[model samples]
Target chain A: MPTRARRWHISWLLLAAATIPLLAVVSLFVGVSEVSLAALLSGQDGGRAAEVLMISRLPRTLALILAGSGMAVCGTIMQMLARNRFVEPSTAGTVESASLGILAVMLLAPGLPMFGKMLVAALFALAGTSLFLAILRRIPLRSVLLVPLVGIMLGGVISAITTFFAYRTDMLQSISAWTTGDFSGVLRGRYELLWIAAGLTLLAYFAAARFTVAGMGEAFATNVGLNYRRIVALGLLIVSMVTAAVVVTVGMVPFIGLIVPNVVSLALGDNLSKSLPWVAILGAGFVLVCDIAGRLILYPYEVPIGTVIGIVGSAFFLFLILRPNARVA
Target chain B: MIELKSVSKQYGDTLVVDGVDLTLPKGGVTSIIGPNGAGKSTLLSMMSRLLPMSTGWIGIDGLDVTKTRGDVLARRLSILRQDNHMTARLTVRDLVAFGRYPYTKDRPTGEDKVHVDRALGFLDLQPLADRFLDELSGGQRQRAFVAMVLCQDTDYALFDEPLNNLDMRHAAGMMRLLRRAADHFNKTIVLVLHDINFASCYSDHIVAMKAGKVAFQGAPDAVMQASVLTEIFNTDMAIHEIAGRKIAVFY
Candidate 1:
């Protein structure tokens, strides 16, 4: 590694940190009801300003960044563990399976707490991932890429099931709207659940070295004296928990995890501990930038951050698929 | 010492390796040579506990390979199979550094780095330490993988066809590396080789296996006779001397 590039890399992290206050300020200032610089400085003469800043705007914006960063990091770890750039929580069907659990619970108990639905979804997602992995272990697939295909097909099945249940309940519109990820609802009590995702991301950072070793190969990991099964299981739990928490709070933001990690590793190698913080920061910054773009594009009215991220994320995903030889270091 | 007793492996109705019993002493190089479909690789897999044996016990230094904690055995034994394809793009140093994982997890101590440096230097990988495995020639990649296994610094090193893709000179160099690993490190090496001549020259003990059974096992001198080689290989063979070591010749 070049010394300058390494130093610049650390500096880039500082640069990302520097963007946080700006994102928070932008998030605080822009919304359907805006409080200008004058009002924010005055410490809120009107209750409207306080409600929007404390109860709605700040929480929603913080939720967007938190879940956004968490899901991206989760996606990064899953891709490494699965050893395929194409494998993400979305593509591996983890998100869809989690959606299935949430949908099932919503239909069964109309009065269930959001956290309860999230836990159920997390369980289902974990089960789906285990099912996918079991299929991977049994199939005589010559390539690791074949393993995630099973996840795609399985994800489709869960998505279908979720849609079917939603349609039957006459709540398909509401369900899909929530599931599609709208930061427009980034308000107080509801969005604070995203803090759970932030916690999971930190836990993932702490355990990153284990995840990187597990990524090499089962034989190599076992030879290194790691409890391969347990490490793998823990990785799956993190992926599922982070995915479920984010999905429950902010719905799904595709591709942040899938994209950021690969971009980081192009310079950082496959060491997860070295690359994870960058993945988290880059993810939050990327989402914040997109959210800012959404705010300014139409001025008073706004574009969905999810929609903006979707367009960019989809384009990047296509680039990954079309590149015959992926350059994920 | 490593012991395999009544070890058999079966896939459905197919008995791949059946009722093999062997005691391997803790020293030098032992080559297991056999025909194709003779269960050489599968047997190696069983001994390393990579593949679950159908019926048997594998005890390494008196600890059972199956029942023992994986990390404990990992420190004692290392195996390199043919065709080590990986998707991770890694430098030669990164790959060799994995050998220390059984010791340091991912955080390498200074001592671990020293082991990595020694392994890289041992395989002459210093010049190519920064090159990616995919960017290297097949023989070079093979050497890189060998360096990783050797860097593992275990008492028992097992290789399945260490010479599979090597050209003539590289193949001979690989044999020498194994020999040096055995002698200098005081490690026991068990290999599955296709070339009998290389085995005759480099191995302290020769193990001839056929149809999942041990056809012959003894010192290289005892196994190098024309009649013994012919019966074991099921082909006509001749022995010639290249500096006093018996070299098998058949053509």
Candidate 2:
């Protein structure tokens, strides 16, 4: 029986690993410009196909992989730290806080480099996530449903503040552009910051066991000689930094964090060390598919990946919440 | 030896474990019997460094629990509370393997795997090793947790009501296992038990607590008398000798 289970695990992992690059290749061809593999291979069109592939398609595909995997890993870490299955950066005010930070930089230091903007946004995300956790601690009745509800409320308030300021400064259009996740603007130079998110995701994988132990609760972690508070702090730092990088580079991609981790956990169980790779792979693949579908749905005109994910993710979220037998934490 | 000097835990204005000064010798089973609010669990928590003391000291073999590093203390001592709720869905083997974290962090050595398997076999949990925790019965889960603590290989182990959800057969089996751990492995075992008969049958020493203080402490034979048991529990009780053991009978 155990051997069978192990075999099943490996086969699924292999399938997921093979699916990601296939999706990436498919995503590369789905853009408005006709950059076919044959053309690129033949070097036909005086390097125009190569140029588009390098300047746009490759970067967008890489960005999708990095951001998707990063956001999904961030969701898993957030869920562990919060001890709630439903909490994610998008719902927990982390993305809104990043938006607020971007707005602040735009108003206060308009000439700051992208790296500087990402750092400030990361700090703001850390603070905002900590604030959400603080609020969670204060409320004694921490039902599974109540946690995400609180986060959504906090995100609503922060976004409201950002909107009011943007309206006054006439930066509302730019703010909207930055707040809605669209990969069409992802050029070679614009999307490299997501590599930091990808790096943080790798760091998360190394610390996966500690995060799993921490998710068992404070007493349990202490019993095993783990520094519970330190692990939680580290987890939040990773989550916030990743959120900041993604939001700053590609705007807010809602529910990839929520939907991907939940689906992964449902399939693979919540053992972080065993399940994290699957989470990353599935997350990248899910986003890649969404991006491809978005590009092809309108054929030359595109729906943002954010809109595609939001519509699909919210339905899955509703199913999770409304399911009678959800083994919620 | 585990030594406690004036250990107290206070929450706001209420004192839970008040000025507890005691010493538990090594290499035997000691049962702490008390009512719900008598602070037995709180004192145990303070001793194990799970709950910080308001004003006091706890030393396991002369190493102060507060001053020593957590991993260092963890190697010497381990504690398990009654309500062990976990967000992560771990198999029994995975959970047991975590007992070696203090030594290996996350990468389990071959020796650690041996210890895990030994602990699983000790607890009769080998068959259930691959099952997720939520899939097990309460008694089976309780045994899995005990296996983890045993796999930790600490010198001193404390359990806060280890028999909470066990059926009679498993409860007795658990006591026997703890007794064997004490006798065979030379571990210092401390437990908070509501069942006085089990304490009398299995424990070498019994400490009875009342109103956040130790009312009495001695051998089980000395502490299991009708008058002492009656006063500690605030109930009418009688002691009967069954198979050369003192059994408290209260209706």
Best by DockQ: 2
Instruction: Compose the digit string of candidate 1's lDDT tens values, residues B99-205.
Output: 88777776778898788889988778999988877678888998999899888899999999999788898888889988988888799999999888888999999
Best-performing candidate as measured by TM-score = 2
Model 2 CA deviation exceeding 4 Å by range: A1-11, A327-329
TM-score of chain B of 2: 0.98
What DockQ does predicted model 2 obtain? 0.67
- Recovered native contacts, candidate 1: 0.52
TM-score against truth, every candidate: 0.94, 0.97
Count of backbone collisions within predicted model 2:
0
Candidate 2 local lDDT, A1-329, one digit each (tens): 24588789889899989999999989888777889988999998998999999999999999999999999999999998888888999889999999999999999999999999999999999999999999988897547888899999999999999999999999999999997998888999999999999999999999999999898888888888999889989998999899999999999999988888888877666778889999899889999999999998998899999999999999989899889766544
DockQ of each: 0.55, 0.67
lDDT of 2 by residue, B20-106 (tens): 899999999999998889999899888888888999899999999888888898899999997887667788998898888888997
lDDT of model 1, residue A36: 77
- Reproduced native contacts, each prediction: 0.52, 0.67
